[model samples]
Each structure stands twice: as C-alpha cells, then as structure tokens.
Target: MIFRTPPRAAILAIAFLLGAGFFATGAAPPSASAGARLALGGVALAFSVVALRCARMRIVASDACLKLYGPLFNQAIRWADIRTNVAAESGVDARTFGVRTPVIVLTSDRKVKAQPVSSYSFSGGTDTPADRIAGQLEALRQSS
Candidate 1:
C-alpha cells in the first residue's frame, strides 16, 4: 500500500475551496450547487495528485527475507530478524513524526519503524499515511 500526503499547494487549495463550499452552502442564503461542485472537484484533484506522486509501501516476502520499500525508508529483514508481528494504531502525532499523513506505527525489534514524509493540515486535522501503512503491514504479517 502506498501512503501519500498531498502537497502543500494542493492541500491549501482543497482546504480553501472546501471551507468556502461549506460556508457557501451553510450561508443564510445557500449558494448554487455549481460552486460546491467546483470546490469538490478541486479537492479531488489534490487527492489525485498525492495518489500519483507518493511512493507506496509494499511487502515482498521470500524464503530468505521480507523486503519493504516505500517513500520514507527501505529495509530487508531476514525471517530471523523479525522479532514479532503486531497491530497498532498511529498515535496522536500532528505531522511531527515524519510519518506519512495519518500516523500508523510498525514495530520491529521493540522499535517502531518510521519514515519522514510530507504531510499537510486539513480543515479537520493533519492527514498522516501511517494508518494505511500499518494496515498493510498487519495484513502482510497475518499472511506470513
């Protein structure tokens, strides 16, 4: 799974337009649907760009080792090197962890594997890619 965070410009534009849409939609006099559609389109475009540019994290298992590669970091772990498999949620990190937008934690040898990647703040909060990565890693662990 590739976890990607939208670029600043994209995020800003989306936030602005979406906020505008919400305000416009909720005003004393509702704005036209056309304006809302345009705002939504801009948000979609931002997502598309992030999806295209962000590197995906993947697990390729072999008899010798498990290889993980993605935007932030890469490593190959022989079966013996794996201490344990776990499932965990990304903690309350607001883009400071260098984790992809939506922070998910992956554990290895009593430590959490992390990567430094770009992220942006949304109207709700900052988006982190960790949850997606953690989910993929959990699936890989279960399959193995």
Candidate 2:
C-alpha cells in the first residue's frame, strides 16, 4: 500500500517557483555582482534538487517492509519492527500550524519510519488525511 499526502503537486510547484524567484532576483538588480549572482544561482539549484527529491514524498508498504522516501533520508523497516499505533502528531502540530499536519509518526525504535512530507499550511487542517494514513498503516501493520 502507498499513502501520499494531498497537495503533492502543489508543493512541488511552489518549490519550483521559489527557486525560480531566487534566480530571477540575480537578474533584476543592476549592480548584481558576479559573485552574488553565482551564489543565488547555486542556492536556487540546490533548492530545486531538494524540491524534486522531497516533493513527492510517500510511504510504501509491502509484505516485507515499509519504506519512507524523502529529502532528509530514506528508511525501510520490516513490518514486524513497528510496535505501536501508526498515527499523526496532531496536538504537537496544532501548536505550530493551527492544523494537524499530515505527518504520520511511523515508529520503529522510536524513530520516524515514513510520512508524506509537507508543511502544515499546505497539507490542510482536517485531520482526515492524517487519520486515514494512520488507519491504513495500522491495517498494513496488522496484516503483515
């Protein structure tokens, strides 16, 4: 089973636009130094790479293991390694974003196992998506 966050394409588009804005900044300023332009372009390129990598974040669960793929790192764990409810950090997230960010705290050895990564603002407020993901993961874990 694969669970993905909503607005996956929107996140990718925003990131791409932001990176383009950075590059455009270097073009507009009349006194932009070569060094400044180079620096901005470098940052823009790095953001683009990261955006491409992290935007389509998803959790893949197979019969043997669950894999989390994203920007920071990727991890795969056998379903047997999961020992608790696959759930969202709703309360903790609400403190910062006034919404339950769609981050499933897939736990294994007390570390994150998978999530469809997105900012709270973009991921939406309704806990439905997060809850749905958690429920699906729970189902997968039990079946495994």
TM-scores for all candidates: the values are: 0.34, 0.71
Weakest lDDT window of 10 consecutive positions for candidate 1: 116-125
Which candidate leads the pack in lDDT?
2
True-vs-predicted CA distance for residue 85, candidate 1, Å: 1.1
For candidate 1, what is the lDDT? 0.45
Give lDDT: candidate 2, residue 37.
Answer: 79
> How do the residues 117-138 of candidate 2 rate in per-residue lDDT, one tens digit apiece?
4334334455556666767777
Residue-level lDDT of model 1, residues 1-144, one tens digit each, is 233334533544465555545544453244547766666656655544443323343455565666654433567666555544333333434555432332233344355343322343233333344444445555555566
Off by over 4 Å in 1: 1-53, 93-108, 114-144
Best by TM-score: 2
